[model samples]
Target: AASSGDLNWSLNPTYTGCSITGAVGSQVLSCSLGTVAGNTTLPVIHVQSATTPADCGVVSNQATVATTNGTGGDSDTANVTILCPGLAIEKTADAASVTVGSTIGFTVTVSNNGAGTATGVDMSDPLPTGPGITWSIDNAHTSGPLSCVITAGTLHCTGSLDAGETQVVHITSPTQWTGSGETEVNSCLGGTDNTGVYDNTAQVSASNVTGTPNASAQEAVLCPDLHVTKVADDASVDAGSPIGFVITASNTGDAPATGAFVNDPLPTGVDWSIPEGGSTGPLTCQISAGTLTCSGTLAPGASQVVHITAPTTFADCGVYNNTATFTATDSPQTPNDSDSTSVLCAALTLSKTADAASVNAGSQIGFTVTASNAAGGSVGTARGVVINDPLPSGTGIDWSIASGPGNCSITGAVGSEVLHCTAVDLAPGASESVHVVSATGNTSCATYPNAASLTADNAPGLSANASTQVVNCVIVSPPSPPKQHHPAVLPNTGGPDGRLLGLATGLMVTGGALVLGDRRRRRRS
Candidate 1:
């Protein structure tokens, strides 16, 4: 039996067995035993171990011995020795955002607050597996290709702290993480002598055990999490104006946010901005190297904020719909803190255009009425389709009622009425084009080559796109001067080159419509 620092206990070599010892710490033990022989003293085996620590063998707080004390009249005393490990290192992450294919960073802090100087102590975090995550540490944190200057990283780390000393570690290299599962990470790490006493470097590994498990400290890690949502739930916007909204970042798990962020593809007519509190914010935002570090130092229930600016004006008039996703992640918790929300936009602006701005005096003039959006061009589709713009004077237009009109089949002057169209149930970002044909006057009237403007609405409340097409009646004129009539072929009377070009262009024109259905553009004859 022996007395160690602050505690006293006894054990007889003759005991039934070595009594189970202390808590999960280390200590020093000694014992004395011998057999009486050769007159006075007997032979004895004085066995001593350089280091006898709980972490070395008999792994747990329990210990074993060779002497199972019985009734053999063998009396002896032995001391149990315990050894304390070197120093410990810790880490904390200030994650601003976590998005797919992004790197997370952790501000690692290593401290040797206990007695005993450790030669090489390394602190690091493990890379989580899933859709888009990687493992990377800072070069400064790791000394050379395989060394960490400050007892932290995967390789040969240098001098460690004495009692009450502190150090730092920074992790980098990982980006593009999937937001589907958990992200496991690690914290304080170390090992015994690297040259002689080979000890496995300590680290935290992903426990295959699924389901929501609690967190561990001594074995540190960055548990993952994520959340996504819209600033406001609505998605409809005026065609010509803009509406404001936000994309919030949140965490709804036991682990704090590691590398967190959110990206919303602004629906048609809708536009999304950047995040705040990060190195890059305001206009355009991005997550850079170690931007979203996961250092396993967040207490449960901690959270940060990200700013999202959305405008409804870009959304074409009609119920505009879209989706916004928020992702909040912590290391180790592979894909954690995930939430998604559907967004909506209201029809804000109103307007439309005619198929043709001017119709012939006695011929049919086609007008295609349409509803368009003013803003949120990317917000997707709009729901409602309503239009009501008045038509101009002097031209016959079937839609000339509200816009100034006559009959579906009639030939008149240049006067048209107003027109109104309503298409509810229009899906978000959805649109339709309606055609209205009108007639014109006879060749004898001044309105023969009629002129009229048919105002229309693409999306009520939004801006309008208008195209003007003029139709002149077939000419009923006196023959040009003998020379001009036959051009240079008949006589010498000549016309201006511009007039000739105009005539040539008119002669080349034919009744043919060309509408290219394409995303960009194409060359067609």
Candidate 2:
């Protein structure tokens, strides 16, 4: 028997009682047998592929046998098929977990694992299906020179890969690829999508080649984005005054936020308390170690608010910053907010006094106006300190700064009715004064009240008043004229006898007129 084929072949396990001879492509087998009956069963002969290499395609083997008794010879042919080259696909996600409304990048790689090139290789990926989840191709990462398109949310790519070669595509396009095929897609999970595990699959195939099983990758969807803000009721407040803060926490994500909380550390040396019903929504709050913490669950687009109240006196007379932080379960990052308020501690007292409390309305009066900041009761400097004394409408005033450690000046002329003194700044325990002398011009006598006020930056206005009394002057009468001597009148009494009679009459008339005039004058008085 003789055999020949395109592919190298040989007998298996050495057929006993038979001798074989040939190279890989051709072989011969011969066996000795005594006379035997016809149609007898013979030992089976097995043929196998040899080590010599062969091309891929159908291969054939022909064998011919002859009988020693002059029986007819038999010839038959056998064929074998050879296959090579393989196609495989792998899918991968950039992240194992992704937040809602965030982009999810994916990569699909097709490889040829066989020794020969894979022809007409193609890949298809329909992508994962979920609410508001869209897809596109990453043109830059996708293998060049390959025709690819997305049809009805499915990715179709056609190309050829050499042995051990790979072609890659990134499934991240928001829209169909343009002519250049380099435009990237910004596919993202919608904020309204449900949170769960999502899987993506891809497959590869080629002409006359079977591809590996579909490749898959899983990505977990997580949503818990929290935002927080803090707001103060007052930007600036006087010392010893009450202050309030409002804190808000909101969940702006697709999924419900659990175990969400806000933390606020109170200003140093300040005592804070959350009043009853201060917190809104389903939130429970507590204060410990001068810090306030509020915890609750929040659905998407839900928010919680809390109000904090404290006294400004506990903090110094300066800007105080308060911050709050928000955190939640499954939230990769936390958000915080802050607010600043100025605390004013300068406490000013104003006093005005007239030198003479009883000064008449038409008299000249001197006044002393003093403004002081309490040494122990205040903190920080008082800026833009001003003292105003609007005098009576008709009265004229003169003012001068008595003493102060600051840029001080008096506005208005010396004789003007209005007196204004301004001091640039005044430190705690500092004082400024102004001496004002005013001429109360002609006016009805009466008791009058004079007032002065002081104002400083961040400090409440203060006013003080002093009163002055005016009275009418007393009247004095002149001394009476010397009275006529009666002793001289004795001579006049005798003279009334002769010529004295005429002279005496005149004198008597004169004396009568004088006495009448004196009585009239006394009545008038």
Enumerate clash totals for all models, in the order shown. 154, 5
| Worst ten in a row by lDDT for model 2 | 516-525
* Model 2: residue 513 alpha-carbon error in angstroms: 34
TM-score of each: 0.26, 0.41
Worst 10 residues of 1 by lDDT: 188-197
Regions of candidate 2 where Cα sits further than 4 Å from its true position: 1-17, 22-27, 34-59, 66-74, 80-97, 100-321, 332-340, 354-365, 373-432, 438-477, 484-525
TM-score, candidate number 1 = 0.26
What lDDT is reached at residue 378 by model 2?
28
Measured by TM-score, the strongest candidate is 2
Residue-by-residue lDDT tens digits, candidate 1, 1-525:
222333333333333322425442234333333333435543332322233222222222222233335433444554443424344444444353333224555554555544444434444443223322233557655332123432323422345445465655455434432322244222211112211111222231111111211111211222334444444433433343444344434455444554444444444444544334422222234423312222222234444334443444332334434354544443333222322233334343333445455555565554555544334443434544445444444433343332322222223444545445544434445444445545554432222122222222223244354544545445433333322232232122134332332211112223322222212111111
Residue 522, model 2, lDDT: 12
